[model samples]
Target: MIERRLKALANGPELRAHLLDPHTEAHLEAYAGNIEYGLGTVKMPVGVAGPLRVRGLFAGGDYPLPLATTEAALVASYHRGALAINDAGGCTSVLIDEAVSRAPGFAFPSVRDSGEFVAWVLGQLETMKAVTGQTTRHGELKGMKVTIEGNHVYLILQFHTGDASGQNMVTLAAEAICQFILENSPVTPDYHFVEANLSGDKKASAQSFTSVRGRKVTTEVVLSRQIVEQRLQTTPERMTDYWRFSAMGGVLSGTMGVHGHYANGLAALYIATGQDAACVAESAVGTTRLELTPDGGLYATLTLPNLMLGTVGGGTGLPSQQACLNMMGLAGTGKVRALAEVAGGLILAGELSIIAALSAGHFARAHRKLGRERGQEDTDTSTGQGDQP
Candidate 1:
């Protein structure tokens, strides 16, 4: 029916043939509620890294890291780091906190009116909760914060979205809450909007570093001196030296968080496991620290304050994505937190490998070897020699 309608439009037949092939048309019904205009699917190459062992509060096991990306050496880098962590009995990961926010803006004529509105809204928390409950069974209105700027008020409603990324869930709940507010409040604002762009949704912001967005997780691993020297091809002292210098560079350059390539591993994993890939903007914002242990080993840690993802909703139910989740034994109910832990572990591995490569002066060499075509010449003159330490 949808295809027939498209076929009636100009150049529709050509577009449909390219996008909606016979195979896609056969399973078109399965894509309902997931896509609009429903063309087809884009296939991305997926690579598996690990049997990565993770010891966490919610996740405990060796799981394969399925990464979908076209960039070569990404999977290999993460794979090497995962093996190093496993040699040291894996990383320790913890899901520290979880919450999604929806910040609605209200514009009043005067500061007095805004203050009055905020006070009244605070008093109506119970009523707001009731309205939110009607919107989603899996979402709960955890709390609200009122930020007043001049005559404007931003109501940041925080929610605990069970087993899902909860962007849509929180938005629906917030919309319902706003409707109830508009109807019941004695003080009406001059105007209002459903979202004020203050929640840091799909954007990187300093706010997410201080507060939770989706899921806050911390993962840490201690690699012995021998292991670092053997697996990473660098000594613990050299890695720490490079880390300290790199951290200083980040601060001088005013980067949001000091880390090496959190997006590389995370974006790949998110794509493979049916997560909201765009959330990587905020989800990838965090800190990675490497220091020398008292015993002369290396202590590495990664803390992601906005690790927004789910194991049951959005793309997770898709056939390919579900298969990837199943490969890791993390799909469906009671596994979201565990899935988050695995993400933390995966990210930590990438950080370890990338930092090691840079410190050992093998970054460009590895990239040229794995990322370049066989006959591609290294003609760039930015760095004098192809091999430099």
Candidate 2:
């Protein structure tokens, strides 16, 4: 059995027991699109952070966030940050921009043929938009960007997917559009492919970061100086100083974003919400900034450039995932922006916690206390450039 194979490879008896049983096939069927072979599931512990209040364009009020992760102190740290934000009236989140993107490629026998196709493509832009629009009820083809290299052309299609993530929607829409091109265009391409690798889907690339891939959410919070000192155990001035140094480190290290531990919260949040967990690769790339207020308080901002998420599709129909989504009032259409807002809120909470820990010089001590078991030595208690870079 696969369980036996896993046990042999992992060299452990624990896998033996866990793999022996899993959510029944009937239960798994809903979540798994294609169950080529049945293998058991790995379970991770889920933790709750917040009753962290949110003031967002879509999601408003207080709600506890469900973060599914096994990292020892992750939940605790975010929880502490949420407490601090809540103590300061809550985070103000906004889904600043929203779009779903896909890139399709075409190849021709020669440069002249490709140029003819490009001309034909430009001519058919209106018809192309009309044809793809027929594919989905909620989705609309927003725009198209063209790029060419030698005898090939790639079309980057952008869509407003409503409440669904729209990967499938875009794929189906692309197929319809491609078929139209193959049949209706005057110049026939020698070969064609659905994706040209330029779309930057499910990966961290400069294009996806700068342009919209999923949802671009930006959240801001103002913390009172008293709250900063009492809850975070640091002053606003010191935290801002650390942020400036960390920003430089991020730039020197060639990081896409200067945020602290964005992936930590995003991955956990994605899993809990039944979001396409792989989307976190592009979704978590963004910038974080802290400005010391004139009154000695702090103003913190988290801007996520590509937060690809959907509330009505993909793994969301699964019962357990549905339940988790329900907890945050996000289980149907027209709620994705709300879900995105909450995600931005959580990101804010997470980044705040990490910087505060660094400023107080308790960065290593708290990890030592919460991250270990039994009497294991707390060896990794260093607050240095190593932690940031």
Best by TM-score: 1
C-alpha root-mean-square deviation, each candidate: 4.6, 4.7
Tens digits of per-residue lDDT, candidate 1, 341-374, equal 9999999989888888888888887788667755
Question: Which candidate ranks first by lDDT, i.e. highest?
Answer: 1
Q: How many steric overlaps does candidate 1 have?
A: 0
**In candidate 2, which residue pairs get closer than 3 Å at backbone N, Cα or C atoms, i.e. clash?**
none
lDDT value, candidate 2, whole model: 0.82
lDDT of 2 by residue, 13-73 (tens): 6754664355543476564672445465556788778767989999999877888898877
lDDT (0 to 1) per candidate: 0.87, 0.82
Task: Name the Cα RMSD for model 1.
Answer: 4.6
